[model samples]
Target: MNNKRRVTVILAMAAIAPLTFTACAGGGAAPASGGDVKSLTVLDSYNNDPDKGILQASIDKCAAKVGVTIERTTVPGKDRMQTVLQRSSSKTLPDVLMLDNPEVKDVAATGALSPLSDYKVDMSAFAGNSLDAVTQDGQVYGLPLPADTLGLFYNADVLAAAGITPPKTWDELKAAAAKLTTGDQYGLAFSAAATYEGAWQFLPFMWTNGGDETKLDSPEVKGALQLYVDLVQSGSASKSVINWNQADVKDQFVAGKAAMMINGPWQIPALAKVPGVKWNTVQIPVNKPGQTPTAPLGGMVWTVPRTGDKAKQAKAAEFVACTGTEDSQMALGKARNTVPTQNGLHQKYVSEVPTMAAFTKQVEDARSRTGKLGKDWPKAATTIYTAVQLALTGGASVDEAFSKAAAG
Candidate 1:
């Protein structure tokens, strides 16, 4: 999440970028013998509580079902990839690893991960976009336990007071935002920092406007950039957005400094705790009346690293498989306030958690950040966020932001 670690991951990943899946003969090494081989070393970024407990509970349940003990190492998200790379080079990678969806393909391309299919991990139940994030060259490498995307979160009371409904189109959004701007509270809040979080937040606008990641300097992208710039320049949004992350944006909304924000379902649990802060969500507004919003799919997927020992790998795969079962996915998604990645469970999940209906619909047509460019997506993500920072901070005009940022 920090710039240093992000750049480190980008550089470290290139060291093992070979695209191969040839399993080592005789499975390299074995764990312990017989009954001794009942535990597995796992790595993940569930360092924060409630989420950490939820993930561990599911993992504990799965480990029991699979007849194994889990020895999990919780790391901060910014350090997980660094730890993975260090352990990888030492041939001591964890038996099971949790990776951000985009990083799944990057690590897989390095041939440092085992194919889930090799261990009979059923891949049929996952959503198409969620599955695509972990697949490369026809090999399925990981299973996404939950999938998420951004939507418009609005304060119901504020909207009612302003006599404004949630916007349905870009023009409506701009008008509503302008009308909502009042004393000490801006109409909207969103991240536009020079980080991947910023790029993640911008996807709906960029994609819904017919922008392409492959063409970063296109008119559509500039138009999307202009939307954010206009909001900030008009004082409908704060200039501090150039430094805010999604968390900060949420905080602004909770404090009533912003009436609307673009965020994902994962924040629901926290939002619920703020007494009487009634809120509701809608799909991200489209650029035009006929256009559909397409947001970037987001989640951390479970993977089995190439730990050499076939037996451990198999057990790890079973553990990974267990985490993705419909029951586990639903339980974890509910506890963590996220959407299940299994397509068949969408209706059931929404029925049980009606607040997530908007997100479920968005996830149905969501796009993977790495789907088009695979491992090369990081570079494009950097370009996107840099352009966003520049445009939002007045460092460059919307028409020049992409070209200038791309040149850098």
Candidate 2:
């Protein structure tokens, strides 16, 4: 369930009247001397995402345990919430806000987020790249709730009928794809249109080949892109995938229109539930023999905004601290098919969504986005997709497209 929000700064109840902002750090980062314990405002884009809902629920759960209630305000998407928060620099930019993995550094660059590392929370305990994505300039900036990795999805029945095993090495994958191309089914599927899905879908290829969007001209880049071109030119890939968007590809993959796809941990639950269908996940085919598995990291974090409401900031900080635990976080993995940033999420997730365990295994070796973090990361991804789309149109060579893209 992506339905989550980062609940922040409650402003009601406590031993006080109405509530006035109080500021200051307590010993070992406790709530300030004077604070409001009654109401808090959380800014989040999860209202539509639903996947981020765990954050809001956790805050509410923890608040009850500690005796506090939260008033959450959800934004439609990243742009809307970031716009509001940016404009409200002088005003309190909602007590807490949602921060995606790639945007952690950018948001911190604005000097808006309060450092959780300086507070009561111990940063290292978080799972995966939580600390890397949120830490900026050697300071912790935000707290990521869900952490995920990218990989390939397959229709188990389809693979079984074809008498094929999941490919373990990159070379084997190509041969398998060649073998699996029995009919309308393609050995693999990926989006090529200039968009998020198209761009994100290409990352695994990039990573496996030792290339990334940032270094699109590397030889590995050429080899990786060649695979996509082969998938299309050989009529083993779907053209609609290029521009139809992410949801389209997922629906198609789930409906059995395609045999395999590259995706993130977020889709694990829904994919597992495909009725009368057998589906399984596996890491992207490896590039080098005996090398560790690889994938692109995905997910978001929670951050607090400072507006002179020291009490509100302190409350938001504590609420964030509540959800950053390994137990609570991995427990979430069971519920959402998401991976926690902490290490202990293994047993928790294995018990709930076993199919996802392979996906989570990549966390220790997965790579985050190479481009600098920013609220605009999605925009950059879009730009890269544009290059993919243009190349897929058969208008230019993959090298030309990426070369042009790199310069662009």
TM-score, one value per model:
0.91, 0.83
* Candidate 2, 1-408: lDDT as tens digits: 232322222222443443343433222442343555676677776665445576556667766754557777766664754565564663557677776667667767778778876566777666535577777777777887767777777778888888889888777777777777766667776656665657777777777777755556678777777777776776677666676665666777887777777767676556656776677788888767765666667776788766567777788787777777765676666666677777765656666767777877876567677334445566557656766776777766887876566556
lDDT of 1 by residue, 1-408 (tens): 999999999887875564333433335554553344689988899999988998999999999999988898999999988998998887888989999999988899999998999998888888788988899889999989788899999999999999999999988899999999999999999998888999999999999898999999899888899999889999999999989999999999999999999999888878988977899999999887788889999889999987767878888888888888889999988887678998899999999989889999998889999999998998898999999988877789899999898888
Among the numbered candidates, top TM-score falls to 1
Model 1 TM-score, 2 decimals: 0.91
Q: Highest lDDT: which candidate?
A: 1
**Model 1 segments more than 4 A misplaced:** 1-36
Query: lDDT of all the models against the reference?
Result: 0.89, 0.69
